[model samples]
Target: MARAVVRAVSASPTAQAGGQVEEDPAHRTAAGLLASHPWHTTPLGVPGGWDPALRATIELIMGSPVAMSLAYGDAYTLIYNDAFATILGGKHPAAFGRPAADVFEEAWATPGVGDVVDRVYRTGEPFREAETAVALVRSPAGEPEQAVFTRGCSVVRDSQGRTIGVLTVATETTEATSRLQSLGELTGALAGAVTLDDVARVALRYGLSAFDVDHMTFGVDDASGWRVVRRVRGELLDEADERLPPLWRRLPLDSPSPLAKAAGSGTAAFTEDGTPLREVAADRHDQRQRAMAAIPLSTHSLRGALTFGRRHAHLWLPAERAQLTAAADLIGQAAERARRFETQHGTAQLLQRSMLPEHLPNLDRFRVAARYDPGIDGSAAGGDFYDAFVLPEGRLAIVLGDVAGHDMHAAALMGQVRAALRALALANPDPVVVLDGLDKLVGMLGTGTRSHELFVTVAYGLLDQRDGGLTIASAGHPAPLIRHASAEGQLATVGYLDVPTGTPLGLGGAHRAMTTALSPGDTILLFSDGVIERRRRELDDGLAALAKSVAEAVSGDPRNLCALATSAVAGATEDDVAVLAVEYASTPSRSATMNVPPEPTMPGRVRQWMKVQLSAWDVPEAVIGAAVLCTSELTTNALLHAGTAARVHIDLTPERLLVSVQDSGTRGTVTRAHTDTLSSRGRGLGLIEELSDAWGTDPTVRGSTVWFEILLSEDRENP
Candidate 1:
């Protein structure tokens, strides 16, 4: 066992109460404090009469660099080096010569410090503590922060070999402990990353914060070659540059490149100046950015590099190097995990798509458009699905649903559920009956297979084109949206078709059908929860956003509406998104015109109006193509030149289709044509004449008229 510090020094005990004693000049300040105190009234009277061993021990410890504190002569009087005064904080000068117990009256309750001191003094035993947390007034503001210390205690003795007091040596460990915690957090963040990209993102983010470095880079080998992500002062670089994956033009790492050297040898590389990497520098402006260090990310199957740098020159401390090493190891492990997940998910996704419908029914009465987008992890599969098909009696059936998983089981379950729903719908056209059967099937599957995640949310809709009747049912799914618009340029309206939301599949609950009649150009949209579920926003907000996007699109054509609705939001799709849109077009339209407002939103509103008019008329899709385009051109011209509201008139007959744009402008050609993509007033009316069978301009009663006509095709088509 360790014993208290004892320095050999010759000192004879002073017999007189007021006799002189030897002292070191360099340490006189501390010695003076001892001398200035009223020792005459204390148990260990005047310094002159103090024991020789105590005097010699005090003299030796007072001038030492280490933080040491000791009590002596049964009074357990306190004495310490200048370094130890900081540890005492507010309890220093007054505690100098008092008994340790009296000075540390409250602290005596705490273990490790006071108890260890007392035990050592009483039993002549030595003790050491690896780490002890003590609350101390460590700042000038008299506030306390947790301070950790490694302490060693031993009994102090005098010339007679009898115990005097306890000596304690303490070294602060707060900084080291904090570093350890930081490393733990980084490891956890890396452990949670789900993809190679996620791993790189977390690694760079943590490295930037933890190391406080000016530059960082993460490189990995993947299907996209040896790709690297670099950031300067935490700003990601080479994002807009197409040659980003490699980050440089060079095929292989150069001989002198810090990254190359470190990765090649599986060790760290350090450099003072960044000139060695100037050849592969992102640009000339950052050629001299200081180089700090580079470490390799290595595993048996994968190898890459993580490099860090600062703007100013600095050397890596041992502790800092060790921290970087640990961080690199975690990133490598995360990369490996990401690889496995991506591979497994890719296979699952292929299976998922194979199970979904390859095509929607080509119904002549209404247009159908469906789309399925897997979540942010593209390689991963989800349970979301969308399907549209014609029933035996000619009604169109649409289904959108989500299963509860990201694995193969969920995808397979989604396929089975979709097929089962279709089968039941063919037998019975009632939306309520079809969904009830699906609910029972799911409940049985969960019980039979003992699957933890067999829950499903589904919405089913059946539409009869004859009466524009649409019936919808839900099993805890988001309500479908119905968008209605007028061909006369009225504002399009979109709202949820409030269907009774019952318990999710596997949980038996009452399912009810809501019947609603669609207007001439109404579209019903069915979508999975992924379309409305978001990480940063509430489900209500996402629903509102979807409704707003649908309202703006308002294209009676299902395809256009589907495209716009899916493109409405930002960010990666974190869940599977499935959408099915079916527009009602039972009534045949003959003639219609939509008012063109003179505003920035005019272009989009005009498109929706024309789409609504054509769908209401059940106009052939092939015939409506360039006609819509050229009509938009004429309206924009009238709005630009006449500077007044314009009318887009669509007149269809058995033999031909005619469209005219009229506005209150005196000129035959209200506006000059432009060569811009948005305003296809295309060079002149000459381009219009070439596209249509014939075109001409005439003076109307109020202003002017630009008209075009095309021979209708023999075969009718649907979009």
Candidate 2:
């Protein structure tokens, strides 16, 4: 009980004119306690001689329902009501008539409380604290516990406005404030998680710190019910113990365990007896976990649960269970989003791979490598592709192109264009002719379709194995970069090809081919615009950076060079990327030219000249046999069809041997007709095709030159 002292004062006749003030029951209760207290004989003197301001303030505090107190006089005597006495705990009656510091010695000694009280008394100004924490002994024999309070202090004044005491009012908010702060920290930590594993790791780390638990396990629902994905032990575990049993690594959702029940009901559950779950948790760990809790986690596409364990038997409070449930919900939502994205990304990759080539063709004269990467947005497939294949006459055709969209439609169109180009290229050896045919094909395919405006940019090249040069043509595509070796053996980009940029396919236009020579040890690089058309970067800057990277990796392997180039720009652009690098291997050059008369003996003369040249070059007998047969077939076709003399040229290199037979008449196009089984005259081109690795025709100043190449056997030693 708390007490207050009442002073008896004799009133003058004028003062007695006003009716006597009514005594409040709360003030009377305190007065009775203070009258019997020992401190009644102290310097404060039973409150009879107290100042008018102190007496008035005490009366106001006793009458109010608010918890308040008043400290008066030089010694600051204590005076408070029943409401405030509850805060005093067991010290209420003993605290009566004593100085404020003596009654609340422990609390007054706290940093902010005492200072605030003194400042309000001295400055005659109000002081307030939104939240103040103090350690105080609520009972005489009890240990001190920390309590948080929102306190306000103001000066008490008499009728003349002279300060005489300090009045204080306070409210305790320890539990509410602490819970809010802990929940805030947990939410902030979970916001940064972007993957399922990230969510598990972050939740485990913060949940353990925020809750009272010895260990925690996080489980997610999968094909095998619920499985623990992460396990974390609290500080109670011994640091030296490395052997711990795998506890609760897997749990069946339909089981009678607390975690399962919680997940099934979508609610929080707890158990004091760990025996029910001990079998599942029986790992190498020796800690006697006697108590546990389960919090259900669920979202639109995800279902999971979290379990917490304690070494001693304990009951969870309602507040603790609520916080755990909220945290579990956050983790479930984040993980669900991550899993959805992963599935979409995997599907897009599968679709993109199906559209691109599995591997570039293996060439003996050139080292070829190519790479394709999808756009930054991983959900949709982009339209970038690269192809390398053997053409007639030992030429290698490298194609890199991009359709004008970033969806499945674009990928489908890319596949159609690629297949059509390959089929057309086998019949015609000229890049210009190939592009012209491709343009018409694309136009026909796009007409009257939703993708009528969809166009494709392409950079196609035919590599001449005999001279180690490239004949390139562009269809509104970025020019190919040619790297030339300097005298010091260092490589640099000579320049982009100067080919005329024709209109993109799907529209009608004339396409021309430009010739660029590549020496041994030189490389030709072709790429989609995604490599040099990044956001916020100028086209020239990107091209310059690409050139620099290529020059630096000049001595690197062709496969590694392609990887480096694609990686540099893969993430910087939103378009799909395709890069192809072709390096010419150095080979000894040899050539023999012979003129064949326009006679019935032309085929025999051509074969004799090929045999002589091949024998002098020390070629293998297998290759000599194939080369002679292919030469005879080509010579007979040229002299019989063109009605002119044939100019025969045989060029041999370390990789392949080229046979060129030119005629005085011009035949720009040669089609491979399907010959019947009994037709002998039409089998000339068929036999040439069957015997040679590749064959093609190129129009020259005099006439047309048709050629074929036979790939030499690897077992034959190079000269």
Candidate 3:
């Protein structure tokens, strides 16, 4: 049988009759080890007498460059190339001729390696794993450490197609895999940052965690010099001993420091000694850093540097330096973007403020307050605006409007629209008529500008002090919210005034005005769509929230109401918000009325009647003097211009005293005359204008009324 087996082995293509063929030269060391091994004392006989399959497999293993090994027979005896010997760490020489189970006893117990080999041998199958962790005794002291490896195992078969051994090819991947994962996390953290401070916080946190550094500092180049903006130290440092510097520090730009050099040259610099940085340290005694590296960061808007320190005198590897450089670049780009955004935001705020009304006009019958909040970024001007001004005939005009876009063009268009609306309101007191004129003007404006498709939504209203009635006209605008006390005197009862709205301005349409009677202690709110618009929410749901908030704050002041409405809704939308609130006072105004004949002495009679009323009202002498002069001038003009009997009316409030003179004559214009030294007839209107705080005229159904106001001092006595 031995002779027959030998003849069969000799007849095989891979074997000779007396011994195995010479091994390939590519794996000389492995071939030499197997040739000198004591295989006869173990599972297999001498190498020359081995089975043809085993001999062929050994020859292939000896010729490969990868870390490959073959475990044959039931005992799983190990045979490997010289390349694989390096993977065994300290056990290389002794494990060369031993069984894989004995050489890697601790690793054999792990499922990814030893179990995979056993299964492949038993089932005649193949298995592969990438970045698999195996606990192996790689440390010099025989201690096990978790090492990652990309491993492949296959069942080796004999010429008769019988499974004989398991073949494995492995490449250690512990260092490279860790590096890739750390870089991925760092990139993700930097991508979400939105501001300079956010960038600093995220970069420092991730850098410290990923690099395991003792300390880190970030510096950026500005017009003045390079400045340190952020710093962090290892968690192991003593809290009492680690005294950080102030939040910011200026470094000499032309100095020999690593940060300055790195930023100036746009390259990385390193130093094993941190004595240079320690020289300028706020707490010199805490200079425990030994290894330091300054990496450059550059972006379109900024150039900066990042410094990393280690407590031990360890040299930074090339891979580590490359990773640090990459992380710094991401941080620099993000920070530059944030800086540019902030600059734009500040400019937009300034432009928007300039476009909107700075102070609402103080009126006799209404308390007005307004607020405007831009979008989250605040980097673009929005088209929302509000205005409140006193008009003729004891009426106050309040306007809230929004243009179609958010940009500089929209803001500019808003200013033009607001100015047009004010000019139109002065000519036509009716809200609907004023809106019609505004629509035509806005249409004309759009046709001449690049924003021809832009439109404006407006809620314009007029409040009559005579009867506390409110007349509102909407041009594709949200209805005003009304809050008042209930019949039982409970405050904060709220309701919406829904009226038919016309097409927005710039799209010509006839606007209809709606009238509502307002009682004392009533409040009205007008707002842009942003006030009730929210992300992923129904418009009605947002409106409900707005209504609930308004009802809760109805009893508060108009300023507080505007604040509440804005704060409640501004955070929920990216659009701009504008809110206007008006609260009607409860007390009726005090007044005195008299009729004057169209006589040359009418001015004297009007002054005497005003004096009696002033005395009864306990008006201040200074304000009374001014009021009498204004009344004399206004009544005299009404008589001279209208040629009709003048009806004089005086109304007093805590803030001002108003006088009105009505004549049953055709409406006439009032102009401030540039009176020469010899002129007498033209000086009266100019004198009235000079003596009053504010004055204007309004035409009535049968006549015209000229009105003037004198601001009362706080010391004036009130009835």
Candidate 4:
């Protein structure tokens, strides 16, 4: 049975490479490559001797008709059936039994394919890309072409529950796809990837390098209907017209127009005059139009067609017709790849954001806002992460760090580092101690690691909510910038914090902290290297430019300030960028704090204390009642879910009353108090939501902070 699965991949009768027929040596099928090849020299080492799990998986995919590939073992050696060999372009035959990395050399560098494959293998997380543009044959016989593949991946685990490899099932959807993404511009990397219109623009740019046409149109189908996109060559149309997509017209499926007929019938047609083409594109196909050609694409699966028009009457040679088909093929490939690249890149951003803090604490004392912009090559998650949370006392912990990578591993490591920092900060609120512990943990994480680029730079600071005092520490990170303001809230001096620098975490170094007092209305800014570091620009110059930009344009608003800081390098995706701003208020608010254990009586006890405190502070009678009721629900939530000591804090001002309850986690344990832990706890949150003016649960690194606020406005305070 094992050998039966092995024989399924034996050699094909004929093999083709680069539009040339190949001889017997490399003319074997997948099965032949598996059977006759020297497996001992490769990573798989004795292919047919694989475990039952590997063999079973192979047998499962072999009987199927989809284009699928199997990457086995740690090295992810390749194995695919005949269906997949069609899309391999020039990579096949030679790619039959090679490591995925070695086979898809250029492809391995991009996202959606190589990064996703590596991530799936390492973390056992499956990934699916819609239209991953794979450059299979860049210049097949001097005719540059592309193949678009949409593939799904899943982990192949052994019986022992250990992940061994990744199984990929792919479908070539280039012809059927419509939403074409930009595949980098002809000038290379303009506005990121270029659009379907851009591909036509490229083809038309060099006059198709051979085929001459005054105008070109590529017709595609989507949910709306079949649509023909037209492009007039060489500034024949005004700039405004060229910038728009199509004429916003939908061609009916059964229409008699040439474009419609070609798409519907899946056939290619040519007209010597503009009479037939004038029905749909009368504006572009004027009387002077010499000829038009409509060629159906892979209509059997993907419904699309290509139309080209010539300005002068000319003979239509067979090679010229072939070039039109080739151009259409290139466009179809771009459309598929563009869609695939977008979906894959979007998912990577989602994964990166998922690891970040879901909600920043709405602390009344601090005005905070954070901004994160992914790099241009967003196929992988950038390791830059920022976190802001409430510590033991009223101290607000603000941390922003950059891990040394732009992949899943880096993003995962960033999450781990952030989690560890939060835990250490919760146990000990001292800035220096928290970083010292992180430095050690980061060093420990580096031991026995394959990557030599295991460096981490972090900026951690603690701001006392009770006062404006702040202590900041750094580990090979840039110094945080602080913007001061005068009593009148006017613009003031902005400069870097005097933090004592140390080596990036993982490399041995001692850490230190520097203390500074922020006057009321002042703000501190923390950012990743992406903000000040521009491509082909000096570091000192960037710093100087940022300072001047802040002084001239930035106001006291934290949101506005952070926005400008992140956009300093504007549209440049050289690296992952992040900026966090925290502002200190001028006025003080009265506050009271108490700790509640997991005991059943803690809720009632907390309510009584909250009531007495609110009444003593002269809070409105109606507001007092609502505050006490909401406090009880929050306290009950902690008592039921956290199972540890919790802190209840109440802050009162003339404007509104803010109450927060945070669970003090079990030392060294990560506890997430999800809202649906139990039916009663869920109802408890429900009750809080109903009574409080506005309530929210902050997702902390460890445990949770459930907060509610009651505005002191009339009619609202009483409720």
- lDDT of every predicted structure (CA atoms): 0.66, 0.66, 0.70, 0.66
Query: Which pairs of residues collide in model 1?
Result: 589-617
User: Model 2: C-alpha RMSD to truth?
Assistant: 29.4
Could you tell me which residue pairs clash in candidate 2?
3-30, 4-30, 245-283, 245-284, 245-285, 392-694, 392-695, 393-694, 393-695
Model 4: per-residue Cα lDDT over 107-206, one tens digit each: 6777677888789889876565667776654333434355677666777775335577777767677432211111111111111123444444444453
Worst 10 residues of 1 by lDDT: 1-10
Clashes of 1: 1
Tens digits of per-residue lDDT, candidate 3, 416-486, equal: 88988888888888988988998888888888875668879999999987777989999999989988844
lDDT of 1: 0.66
**Clash count in backbone of candidate 2:** 9
**Span of ten consecutive residues with least summed lDDT in model 2:** 669-678
Please, what are the lDDT tens digits per residue for candidate 1 over residues 80-108?
76767777776766677688777766556
Query: Model 3 misses residue 364 by how many Å?
Result: 9.2
Model 2 lDDT per residue over 1-719, tens place? 11123332222221223233344453245544433334434555534335433444454455444456777756777767676788778787667668888887888877797777788789866666668878878888998888777666667664335566677766575445444444433433333343455566666766677785776777667665665543546433332111111122345668666666776678877877655366554443324667888888876567777888777778787868776775675566556655665567667767777766765765666877676767654557778988989886789999999998888888888998899889888998688998998898888888857566787988888998777877889899998877765443445545677888988997898889888788886778889988888777778888887777777652423554565577554235767778888878675457788998666655776788788889999998878887888777767656544455778987666656777788875221122221111112334566676777666554332345677777675653332
Q: Write the number of the candidate with greater TM-score, choosing between 3 and 4.
A: 3
Taking all chains together, each candidate's TM-score versus the true structure is 0.46, 0.51, 0.51, 0.48
Model 4 TM-score is 0.48
